[model samples]
Target: MLHCPRTVARTIVYSGIFLATGVSTVLAADPTGDWKVADGVANIRVAQCSGNMWGVVAWEKTPGGKDKNNPDTAKQSRPTLGMPILIDMKKKPGVDAWEGEVYNAKDGQLYSSTIKPVGADQLEIQGCVLGFLCGGETWTRVGPPIPSSPSNSMAKGAPKAAPGAPPKTAAPAAPPKTTGAVNPAPAPKAAPGQKQAAGQPADIGDICLLPDIARFAH
Candidate 1:
């Protein structure tokens, strides 16, 4: 759904990295990194939390501004600073696709976003809700973590905090279930899907998201 030129640019940039470095290496680029949005419009400070992911709008600035981190947007409901966005990603079993919420930076609202990993260096980010009227662009594997300042001791690989600071303990187990409520039995299985016989269409779900959506009928 993205405009032709942007789509083409993203594909070239992302695919080049994928081919050169292989997919697994790219996937290792943690969502928890200091990711700069598209052309450095804003910096999202990301970190993993309780097995989920969270992003804080750390730094943002207008195209050419005095304070790089302070945009001159309204400071009311849509404040020009200090906001955290939470993304919940779940895997769809049938398609093995990642579907999640993407925050709208302008209004501070979440939208349904689906991402499918392709190779190591690219993820097709679909920024839409309806199936057809969607725009998507591939995000290429960016460079490694930015170097830390020498003044920061931890940044220079200082020793970590001792592990003896009260290791996390597991919660006590629940008491055994006593009520004799019988669990339901498994249901009968459905017939298997047809193989690639008689000119069957390819499974688009397994195909890379960008290419697949590009070929999707309007």
Candidate 2:
């Protein structure tokens, strides 16, 4: 092959551009780590799973939390610690954004969600039940990552589910008993499918701050 000077120079320029683009893409779109949410009241571990990403609750401020608000009657028995909050996130090509579903423990609803990094250290996680009625929280990358909290063992072993198995939905807690210690944040009266504000709870302020309530109010 006859190497022309002009052709060689053009090839070098193109190769440099391609390398730079690849490097930037690699650096920009990874969200693998422990993320502090709810004003550091809760933390989740995000990791790659089945060609996507999932986040599970590693810790909560409130001890031995339960998902008292879940809609699934059967799931109310599970503890809130190992519940999957951020589900099946797929990265948007050429951007620092991911699309996923966010499970809100407050109302037991899963909203369409997106996670976008505002800078190197912070991520903006927004979820929307409807376009106008949406809210988000800022998550800070806490550290490289810690071992899955002892409480989160249910979701720690496998990154992805088995083939043909149903996807793992958010774990729910058992139905509340008439113990009088039912400390769930009250969901305000709304029409069907109308969700409460991202962080604000309903009218129940009498209860103490349990893990359930601490992460609800914005």
Candidate 3:
């Protein structure tokens, strides 16, 4: 956690524009960890994967919510529990910034995103259009990465267990029937998550990442 004054997160909501306050900066080191959104309602876990960084909705206080604005019809009501909102981010050469894409669950649009680490804890994450229109928050680090249980770590194709942590066993499979098995059938193709054809939105986003920042203040 960042060592700073207990301040409330307030936004200058000026005709679809947002400016985040409360500033303190330091060397922007590795931004791969759990970060508390400005409003403190959700925790985003950022990690390095496959030579790129990815962020997911690690935990949310929003109860039983689904992606209501997803453009994909088939995935409209998908749960946000473990969704990847920030994908395929690469660190910029010689800068404390990472460039990538951010998925806005509110409008179902993917905006070009960049994250610049201020201090060791604060991160300025802005998602925007071609170059100018943008919105973002100064996220504070919420300690280290949320420790993944052995089972969950393994399930995610990794065994990033903590030091001295024990390995967990997978759930048992169902027993085979004492009869001839039927042949498997092919499944239908999946829908596209995003579009390639381009044209950006005039406003990137309206949702304040952590609208209720005070609720999660330490």
Global Cα RMSD, each model: 25.3, 15.8, 19.3
All candidates in order of TM-score, best leading = 2, 3, 1
- The TM-scores, one per candidate, come to 0.39, 0.55, 0.54
Q: How many residue pairs clash in each candidate?
A: 2, 10, 3
Question: Which digits, one per residue and each the tens of the lDDT, describe model 3 over residues 88-167?
Answer: 77889988788999888879989999988776778788999887688888888764532222221122333345988886
Candidate 3 has an lDDT of 0.56
Best by lDDT: 2
Inter-residue clash pairs, candidate 1: 23-119, 23-120
Whichever of 1 and 3 has more lDDT, that candidate is 3
Model 3 ranges with Cα > 4 A deviation: 1-28, 145-218
TM-score of 3: 0.54
Task: Point out the higher-scoring one by lDDT: 1 or 2.
Answer: 2
lDDT of each structure? 0.41, 0.61, 0.56
* Candidate 1 to native Cα RMSD, angstroms: 25.3
Error of 1 at 85 (Å): 4.0
Q: Give the best candidate by TM-score.
A: 2
